[model samples]
Target: MNDGRRKVLKAGVAVAATLGIPFVARAQSKPVKFAALLPLTGPFAFAGNAALEAFRDATEYVNEVKGGIGGRKLELLVEDTGYDVAKGTAAFSRIVSRESPDELLFVYGDSTGLSKALAPEVARLGLPYSATSFSSELADPKTYPTIFVLGPTYSDMMAGLLGEVRRRKRAAKIALVYSNSEFGKDPIPFAKAQAEKLGMQIVAEEVTPLSMPDATALALKLKQAGPDFVIMQGYVLTVEPLLVRAAKEQGLNATFMGTYYSAELALMQRGGPATNGFVVTYHNAYWYDSLIPAVEKIKQFRASKGRSISYKTTYYMGSWFVVDVLGEAFSRAAKAGKLTRAGVVESLNNMGDYNADGLIRSMKFVNHRLPYIKLYRANVQDGRFDAITDWITVG
Candidate 1:
């Protein structure tokens, strides 16, 4: 060692010994970590469980397939919130308290309620967050700077659907059916404004519980409206089939449509012939689609562990996709030597037209949310939602 440097080091050690202090060398860098607060064991367990599975596999995919983030392994920290807002809030605090600010750079939230509740905290921390929700309320970069929707917001999807309606038939009469919750109510105002902008009439606004016990009442309202199209929101498989059958039986004869969540195969399979022509918007490639290179990679990801590939929900596809997107930010920031939460967000905001190997199409983020989407129609005989339109940027 150089004499000057050696003398300085010796003097530092002597000072530490005199003060009864321990001298320690610099600590090694640790793996990158992100928190996932999911609803793994409650009313939303079906969807949450699927997301959990995807995150686990995505962790593996990142560490093994993507060669780790910036040469450091990626770690996913998960918590179950039971699909309750209060439970989710506590879990969010627990995760924040536990992880070092340097490591916990992002979070994947389970629902809209939790996203709203945690908005201030997440933005204050400057850790980028994405959730299963596409609520337009969370899309504002000003109010919630660090909170980003996974894909198109519900408002964007509504605009796309409404625009398509105008294209097919100008000034189409539209009916809106949504649950009585925030998920249902969030996009209605924007949908109405966009409908009016496109010269379409909002003939009816039918509201139901998240799980409607019966569709007889709703069917009557829809039939009375005589809308050119009936768009259902805030429902998955439940109430969808019931409404379809009831509406058709009532001789309503209006086309039914929905957003991404309603684009599940289970919806078509369970709804049967009644859901044959039902349409919805989606932001990712289906696992069954052979042309996507990323879909093939999904198969390879599973086969590496000697596991057979089965049909995974879009919940799985979405959760898997976000982790990779976050990994990209982590990598970019790490390489630039500013691998902090803000650094990651800055990198992500500038990631122009990157599509994560076609998980979605080439697109740009507007207000931190990808507004590009495509339309799909349920082919009940095939038990899939076939793409009816190419990717289109909306709102």
Candidate 2:
């Protein structure tokens, strides 16, 4: 009787194992997918490419180190927006509907206008989004709770430049040159207000389309105004030629200041002698100095990839910041044993004081905006930007 019972038990266990019950359960793997919306093939391609590389690099590093969550590798999907509202909307729809990633790692767009348009859709889908936009409108917690910004707001960067303007005693009689797009238009009002508060008068305000070949007309107007300082805002295409040609032709002696977007080294190289002594607000710590531990790691990453760390690498820094924050949200979701859309959104809402590599001071779901601001004053000389002051932090 005992032998018969033992044989029956052994046979039952073997059958269960052979049927893929216990052993198969041990081999089961979780699935993870990450997707991003970026302007890969449009006006903002430069910034988008850098961000994309950063995300790919970081996730690759994480997977190589066996740091995936729940035994699942992080997968990434990317779509191009071209920095156009309609295009951005369509790209976002394709990813959310067709690809259907578990979470969004980075939605890279430099323009606040495009971000605003897509933020609503992201919220509608209840997906967490970490983006590179600093438009103040996106700061509202009620509006875009699932979205966060990795860079300082445009107004914050502008405020830093204004501080330098006062330090140089050019708060009065300053001319403003900006592009005619949303990126250029986003900070105009805040900058004007700050100018008034600092007793700096905006003597002349000029607009040039992002597609304009030359800024001659704007430069001529600026030269005619003869202001003590000239502050310009625009992407590289417009700002580079304007600053170079304006300084060359007008012999402009004013203290030149630029928004963060004007801090491209490529533009500075093109400006050559004209861009010397040109100061622009910078968001990230210098990528080359490697003085800080965070910068050192970024340098090591650049070298490993056979790429030189430049201001462009900060795009990677910005993108990495996005992933780190989103990772935190996902971690919270995983620990809670639920991956529902509401659960992730709640985790993002309650996020507090999370910093990735010191790139960001703090990011919280406070008022649905990450109240993080740090700015550095950098001037272009010898084909590169040299930091002129200690990093500045603003609210």
Candidate 3:
């Protein structure tokens, strides 16, 4: 048999041996339903489209190996949340009512607000949801439990960046700009606390909607604030160019900074010279780092499919994490002789410190969010984010 067929057959045989399910016989059975809620249309569509591609690819990978847990196929159901809270609510309702997926995977929310709105309902239905939002409020053990975040939380990323500022004794003056959303609003309290503790001056703060028609005026306004550095809480398109250009036009020499989502390769490319000397924080090690086993496998997987990994895309790693979590849950459920939603949840709860080939920090469910977030400092050089620190972890 060829290598591809042999790999699939081996995977099938291993799963069958573990679950004691007839491998070849049950391979053609109906797939277990899985749903993904992402913003395919509306404000956050850029992020949504990226995440959807990742989700689709990962699900397809699992199926290529003869289905997933219990020899059951994985059926992916996708719904567009439109980056609206009400639309998100309705889309979720439809997914639950119509598709009735066994698990929810690769959910994308714009900020803490929408995540909060949906957290209660997802838990009420006992659905296992993996999402992109990483606000610390969701980490509260009392409030949310069904939600699992796969990336570094905003709080964690901020702490890492701030720590570097302190280490370098560069806390002279700092300003803030944010999108008017749950994500934008989330860091106010934490930023206040951290800034005070670190003795960093918060010179000015500004907010604008996610899809603002005129950030040029706001960008000009930000330049007038006159701080030594500016930290932007925005996605790729919203932050890099607008703020950087304004800083230049106004002749403000403050260092530029951004959070995880805004650190994508597209931002650096589009921002051009403006992105130089700007620092942003991220969680995952650069996928281009082939030394990491899981990252290497991901590269190989893409190459095998006749596609080259692009710097503009890394959400595939997020989807890979989703599958890794599911695989852990599936293995546990199979060992226990049942593969129900509750069983999967139980397995997930008990999954401790999963490193997934050390591509990221170990994932641990603390309250409703994954507690282990690792931060990497990177600057834009030649249109890509280059890691500065070896790795930084949060409290």
Candidate 4:
């Protein structure tokens, strides 16, 4: 075997010894199932695959180092949704039907549309569910008691970004460029309201497909509008690079910023020189933040797969965060002698100041969402985004 695989096997052996269990017996226990609906074949395939890899690494860590949740290994069940709401919902239904709800510890939805579509059903079934979406609607604990959001809502991130813009450039004229989807349009209304409240002018609002044939038209439109800043939403990797390149080529001199989904390493690598000075809002620290012990651990695990963690995208970090949060909830529920769906929800509700091993700031849930946000600027020379501001909490 390769050296990395040998190291991982050695680590597993050490963990089994520490737990006072034979390695074979430890591997034989029933597993806690986690079902994930991912868009592995469509526009967001890159992000889905990254998230799946992170999930796999985290599950392996849990089963090895952590001895699993309450002594049970984690078995991940992933289905490809192709970034379609209908396909995602159907996949979720099929998975849940096949797996016992008790065995299935939690469910993860890959898109905002999928999350919204599955919310009612998840609530009806009283199954604990989380999603990659940052939609404000999912933060409603009263409406969807069993659902959890891993980070700030899109509206909150927009508000935080606008707050930063106002701080740097008072009364800035801003344009909103987003994808034509539920994910893209989720925060527009709230953003408009917040912009009005903050005295920032809404210069232009443009919509483009998630995968644009060309961003020339939109870039020219933004140039004509003459906004001081442009905020991009509803994209993982594709549209941002094209839009930024087209805008720069058209001589559009506006500062570009993006929400969580658009703030990814892949964007910088793809956009190249155009990504210089690009700013983004995010809740978690990037994989390069080795100061975070969890990030270091992730790097080691990723190396076992013959990959570098620095190439990981924001979706990858978000997926690992979800796994960490779920592991914490499972531990808490097991301690309370109630390792069930209701118990997990209660544990999640009671959690406070969790930082996911320093990958994020001390996060607290308010209205079922963490209200923290941070700003980062792409350092093109280093090909990484460096934080420009500390955690900013939105009200």
Candidate 5:
């Protein structure tokens, strides 16, 4: 074996020793395969890279430290989709067809569009699937029997923000600003319904491209509408900051909040002063929240790679939770003597509250979605989000 392979095998042996398992026995066992699709070279590349690292670390932990799922080494097959639906679909097809069906127990999708596009194929393959998206459409257990979301849907997140608005300001005037993509437009109808249910006035609804080079017009529009709160949804990293800054410059007297994609340290850093007092919802703990064992593991893993822990983000935490959930399902399947894709789906369906090592609260799947959501305010000074409230269960 090459020097690198030799070292890795030695480390695996050491890990096996710690688990009280013989290396020879583990070497004889086969591997459980997982296929991952990531947006590595596209608009979401930064977030995708962070998630990729988290998956790598989680796979290492499962194989080396945890002695793999049921004594079979965890093998991960990853491909870059560049955030394109067609590319993602092609990648999924290639992976499923190329890999052994029995060995490939689970698949991870990169985007909401991809998840929805491949739902039929996933069901046809009879494999349990997870994704980076939390689209409400994917949460229907009847429609997507094997699909699982890591947290609340976009609609639930919007509802959480609206509930917060109503709690803080009675009969508040709210506006919904979103991008023009599947991700951005996913929760607009639900959010509007929620506003109506809360008796909040829907003042302005604006749609912009994912990359809003000049948000001055939108800012002016929002300024004129003068809503008490403006909820930004379906943006990954750019539009929200520009809108928040432009709106602030335009003297828009509204509290700005965002859905999950806008809740990141990168946003705070990019928006600087404008992001001050900005609130966003998150389904996973931040990197600075090292109180959790999983977070600590991420820290150590990054340190081992000669990188700072600060490089990790909320996206990384989310992806780690994805893999951890898969590990849990695999374990349960093994226990049931049904370690195939269908078995994993059955295990996921029967799962109760799972906290992913306290990175989030005890998550119970309601219609294949976790109903936990938490609010965080941007601390521009530190470029991090501070919890504004405890975990709120969304209906």
Candidate 6:
């Protein structure tokens, strides 16, 4: 200590001692924050809202239940990007600049576009990035070291779908249908290659807009192609049902299928009769599977707060699965005493088979994405999805 400062501190201590007063040092516990860029108001509001709810509950579980990480409470910092790429990038920039690396452990972004746009920046900052996107492009650890996909890449999901096609009918004729967007088109090439590998034929490849100008025309085109099955990509709730109805009206007897969002319980309700035989692939358990521990925790937490729900969307369940994975990483990092971004990434890379109470099956990230998934068949009569196959590793 400097002499002048030391003498002043000693004089203060002596005065306090003579007055029977004691001096104490004060320190505040810091929070390990996971900053999120979510689209809470625009096109993807439904998704963002579902995810936000999970983030909130997961934060509570960590801090209140598990005593937080290394005694530093976990915090969720959300910046609404309104599903806009430009705004998402702006939020990422602001968050990285404003948050201290010591406290900011992870960042969760909205979509494939935002993930691609911020790849360079995330790598530069060395901040661990996870996203709602499962684009095949984002699975590259070499290019985007800090970025990871929450589930299997679209390509991996496609493999599971096409494998199902091959299972239902060897040498199955498959038609590819997707919206002409990044989400829609990301897995086509890979699907084609996988189809070829599995000895299946690509009968028709159809592209539609986010809003179908004429749904009938697309259905007629598929009928003309005469494929035994049609696989959809790049859409959530709109085109799958419409085209299935149109194709049925045309007397086309092809099985229709989708992956991820398409297989959601919401889609089953939305599609009605059209979704009866529709097939989809997913990586995690649905929200209604209350027997699962983590999901049970969500149910319990909400009920304790008088905000319980009978059911939630797939996005909600999927979002919780993401949080559980992050929690695991944070826990590992804390135990190792390297609760930083790099430390979390190291733990993630080496996280071989994580059993998060069956939120996901042996959740493992290969090439920064979960390569395992399961197949489900929608039963319109029950308004629920039934598992058709056990967990399959595709990617």
Q: Which candidate is the best by TM-score?
A: 1
Tens-digit lDDT track of model 4 for 1-395? 69999999999999878787655575446677888888899777888998898888888888787888888777889999998999998899899899977778799998888899899999999899988898998989999999888888999999888988898898999999998999999999999998989899999999888797889999999999999999998887789999999999999999999999778777878898998989989888687787888888888877776876555777888899888888888878878987788988898888885788976675568888888889999888998888999888886
Better of 4 and 5 by TM-score: 5
- Please estimate how well model 2 matches the true structure, expressed as its whole-model Cα lDDT: 0.67
What lDDT score belongs to each candidate, Candidate 1 first?
0.86, 0.67, 0.67, 0.86, 0.86, 0.84
Candidate 1 collision pairs: none
lDDT of 4: 0.86
> Any idea what lDDT model 3 has?
0.67
Where is the poorest 10-residue window by lDDT in model 3?
100-109
208-272 per-residue lDDT for model 2 (tens digits): 76766666666767778888887777665456555656656866667677766676666565666
Using alpha carbons, what is the TM-score of model 5? Answer: 0.91
Total backbone clashes of candidate 6, pairs 3 or more residues apart or in separate chains? 1
Candidate 3 residues 308-386, lDDT tens each? 6764265556656576567666657767965566766677777776766665666666564554443343345545566
Flag regions of model 5 displaced more than 4 Å.
1-28, 304-307
Model 5 agreement with the true structure over 1-395: per-residue lDDT tens digits? 69999999999988878876655665448689998899999898987888898899888877777778888888888999999999999999999989988899999998889999998988777778888888899888787788888789999999899989988999999989988888988999999988998899999999888897888899999989989999998898789889988988999979999988888888878887988989999888787786778788777866786876665677888888888888888988988989988898888877676687886676568888888899999999877889999999997
For model 6, residues 235-322, the per-residue Cα lDDT tens digits are: 8777887888788788889999998978777676655687688889988888766677867778887888788667887888887777
Candidate 2: misplaced stretches above 4 Å?
Answer: 1-28, 99-110, 301-312, 336-353, 364-382
Off by over 4 Å in 3: 1-30, 99-111, 212-220, 308-312, 371-381
lDDT of 3 at 49: 86
The TM-scores, one per candidate, come to 0.93, 0.83, 0.83, 0.89, 0.91, 0.92
Encode model 1's per-residue lDDT on 1-395: one tens digit a residue: 59999999999988887765322221224788998999999778988999888888888998998888877789999999998999999999999988889888898887888888898989888878989989998998998888888799999999878877877788899999998877888899988988898899999998888886789888988898899998888876787889998887888888899998898898877777889889899998788987888788987889888877989898888888888788787888888888888888888887775787788775367887899999998998888888989889887
- Cα deviation of 35, candidate 4, in Å: 1.0
Q: Give per-residue lDDT, candidate 3, residue 370.
A: 51
Candidate 3 lDDT at 4 equals: 94
